[model samples]
Target: MKGIKIGEYLVNSCTMYIEPVEYANKIYSHIVEVEEEFLSPFKPLQNIKNSCDYFGVDYESRRKGT
Candidate 1:
């Protein structure tokens, strides 16, 4: 699959599977906000084990597009 390599992370340009929720509307709302603000809308590849595996840096503290 074609994707962008941001540091060591391979972010696939595809939509990921999100499980449907029944209750916990408040929690769902927070999740939506976090996805919009922090998580990028890219599917994580299965091959990638850790962020350092691709980016050549420590996995503890690393930013995307760095």
Candidate 2:
């Protein structure tokens, strides 16, 4: 779980968002990158579509106003 610090949070290379919720209140939303290692573990059994299945969010459909 190694990542680079972006502003007050850390963003990995896998395009996942991780940050403190309290500080995030200042902004509408927080978007952070994820690391390959984090994603590599799930690569075998998981299929990553738009947004994260873990969050139950349809990132693509949401962006299209669906």
Candidate 3:
């Protein structure tokens, strides 16, 4: 976690964002190792998903105009 810093962390919640001061790959590896303890206890092993709708994918339809 040397080059990694926790950003926009919510207390008592599993949701947290981390920023890397150095290479991104290294940061990802570190997270994978401790994901169980770092993430939700109910489902410790979960696939990471993008929170944004980049490239207009709209996977969750969050930007739908209705």
Candidate 4:
């Protein structure tokens, strides 16, 4: 498994999910673009609406509200 260095920890590309967490005393979340291989093996945002059955990942939106 390929991984990247983040400060002092090496984050692996094999990620199941990503969520917002406190960083530097701030409550926010963001994704970083790895210039080498790829950001991650799985992209939820793109995959969520990427394809109906592509890559064996079926993402369906059931509700919409704000």
Candidate 5:
């Protein structure tokens, strides 16, 4: 899957999953913001991990892309 790599974390691209669409959207946006240096990475990474774990999805897939 396509994703953005921030340091060691991998935030996957927005995909149609069984989970709520908002979760995926948030993950994408949070990572993008981090990449763009608009926000610090800690909170967003925490939220992304929580969302992925809650939905039983793999958010940590390594790929470099927009």
Candidate 6:
């Protein structure tokens, strides 16, 4: 994001997702890191079911941003 580097890596500018309210009294969105290799819009979502299960997120729920 905006070439924000983590260590020696210059992260490429790319789309990012903001997950909200992961903590108490926090109304702001938090940056959720995406794998650099999967940043391309052309790439399919990796490990769909496992990710959803792990994250406790559903496809349509995520789609609606609810």
TM-scores, all models, native as reference: 0.21, 0.21, 0.19, 0.22, 0.29, 0.27
Put down candidate 1 lDDT per residue, 1-66, tens digits, no spaces.
Answer: 122222222323342332222233321101122233222233333223243566576544444644
Number of clashing pairs per prediction, in order: 2, 8, 0, 0, 0, 0
Which regions of candidate 4 are displaced past 4 Å? 1-13, 28-66
For model 6, what is the C-alpha lDDT against the true structure?
0.36
For residues 1-66, could you state the per-residue lDDT of candidate 6 as single tens digits?
232322111122442553333234333333335643222211123333334556677766765774
* lDDT tens digits, residue span 1-66, model 2: 333323222222454543222232332123444323222222221233412454576657645774
Report the candidate with higher lDDT, 3 versus 6.
Answer: 6
**What TM-score number comes out for model 1?**
0.21
Give the residue spans of candidate 1 off by over 4 A: 1-9, 12-49, 63-66
On a 0 to 1 TM-score scale, where does candidate 2 land against the true structure?
0.21
Better of 1 and 3 by TM-score: 1
lDDT of 4 by residue, 10-45 (tens): 233543433344445643323343444222233334
Q: Which candidate wins on lDDT?
A: 5
What's every prediction's RMSD, in angstroms?
Answer: 11.5, 11.8, 10.9, 10.3, 13.2, 13.0
lDDT of candidate 3 over 1-66, digit per residue (tens): 342332222222353443222243333312323333232221111122233322334444644532
61 in model 2: Cα distance from truth in Å?
2.3
Q: How far out, in Å, is residue 56 in model 3?
A: 9.6
lDDT of each: 0.30, 0.34, 0.30, 0.36, 0.40, 0.36
lDDT of 5 by residue, 1-66 (tens): 234333333344542221111333343332443234222234554655666676677666511221
The weakest ten consecutive residues by lDDT in model 5 span: 15-24
Question: Weakest 10 consecutive residues, lDDT, candidate 6?
Answer: 3-12
Global fold similarity of model 6 (TM-score)? 0.27
Span of ten consecutive residues with least summed lDDT in model 2 = 37-46
Model 3 spans > 4 angstroms off: 2-13, 24-49, 54-66
